[model samples]
Target: MMGGARVRQEEPSVQKEANSWVFARSFRSEEEAVRLANDTPYGLANAVYSVDAARLARVASQLKSGIVWENCSQVLFPSTPFGGKKGKASGFGFEQGLAGLKEFLAEKTVVGTSRPSYNWQIYKKA
Candidate 1:
């Protein structure tokens, strides 16, 4: 239970990332919640509270925010790293923790599974 939370996201107070404002609203369904949440330029952090683990995973995956907490809120760890995904709302690529150090380092990806090594026909069901 926190203090007063703004009801609308469009409010000048909420438009900026205040880190305290909450979009206090009730949705008829979960889809509506996800829809309304994704329709924004800011992708900082989001929290999903549900007893159903599957539902939590589904909603977390659908959310475009940089961080999605399930059954928890504001739980941060230096090892886990904290950062935003899109837009200037999250400082673009300002990460905290090991990830922050990695961001400055160079990295590359090498794909070795372009072609299957084993025969697919063997594993295929008749």
Candidate 2:
């Protein structure tokens, strides 16, 4: 409910346990919604619900969280890559998918010449 530049302010809050809910004042615009959501120190995950697909996509893109759910929450899939920020201090990198596999893998490069007589000295001029 927006009228002119008036902004309704409510108490900020957080819940420690599961299934607990905290309520805050409704946002007047999309920019306000993104700002309020990102005001928190934590940005692990977030979710948005809307009948408009384009609006949902636009909002989801601007959210600060690493993972975002559209019209759904916490629907984890094995094939989907999951991880927090690069320096999240979460004790792990991505957990699933090809990107996750690369975290624990060590890659090495190898080279060889197949010529019968090969002169490997490049600095010596003939």
Candidate 3:
């Protein structure tokens, strides 16, 4: 409920294990929904349905959830960055993006190989 209102409902045993869950028929505005989603202690995931692209983007940014779906309820691509915030459980690190690919792999940052080695040595002294 909004504005600190409380309601009573029978929840399943599995739900008790969850941190919290909210089911609302509709939100007055996307901003309100995003605020409610972000106010939770958990940042697991969020689902949003909106026809306006601008509103969707604003809501997406405001959500503290690790993954947000706009007009859909799933992550479709493997190249998108996905992770949970506020210590919510996540499936894995950046899944299919460059960041995700580099998680398990080692990347070397070589600074001087392409340039003159003497130039790097000179800069190292400074």
Candidate 4:
């Protein structure tokens, strides 16, 4: 609705895939905004702008995306885990999290009973 009355709209600055950004007017309510944002196939990232921190946090949690930025553009850090939800856009695994660290380590499970019991098969009557 922001870009005239056309149903489909894209940012005027966008000229190619490298410059992709969909700019649309806000819906009636926050729920509608979340619904429209999550309807996409790719849950790569999403940005929410709001003056109220609580409301911004609430909306961010409802989004289907793995990465959510509030009142700011996308910024990456070495410590923060980077990845998306289930979809083609989502990578194999997180880049900086416990899960990501696990990807580089070997997994092993140790099993044992608190009390040891001998097998009766050795003295079983045949």
Q: Which predicted model would earn the best lDDT? A: 1
**TM-score for all models, in order of appearance:** 0.69, 0.63, 0.56, 0.68
Candidates in descending TM-score order: 1, 4, 2, 3
- Give all candidates' CA lDDT scores: 0.74, 0.66, 0.60, 0.67
Count clashing pairs, candidate 4: 0
Task: For each candidate in turn, give its C-alpha RMSD to the true structure in angstroms.
Answer: 8.7, 5.9, 5.8, 5.2
Estimate the lDDT of model 1. Answer: 0.74
Worst 10 residues of 1 by lDDT: 1-10
Tens-place lDDT digits, model 4, residues 46-114: 788999999999999999877898988678777777667866355565777675686688899977665
lDDT against true structure, model 4: 0.67
How good is model 3 by TM-score? 0.56
> What lDDT does candidate 2 reach at residue 25?
46
After superposition, the stretches of candidate 3 with alpha carbons farther than 4 Å from their true spots are 1-22, 25-29, 86-92, 106-108, 113-126
Higher-lDDT candidate of 1 and 3: 1
How accurate locally is residue 12 in candidate 2, as Cα lDDT from 0 to 100? 30
Cα lDDT tens digits for candidate 3, 55-106: 8898888887767898987565777766566465444555557666777898
lDDT of 1 by residue, 1-126 (tens): 122333565756545666677655666789988986776667888899999999999999999877899999899886676778755366656477877788898888865555565545557555
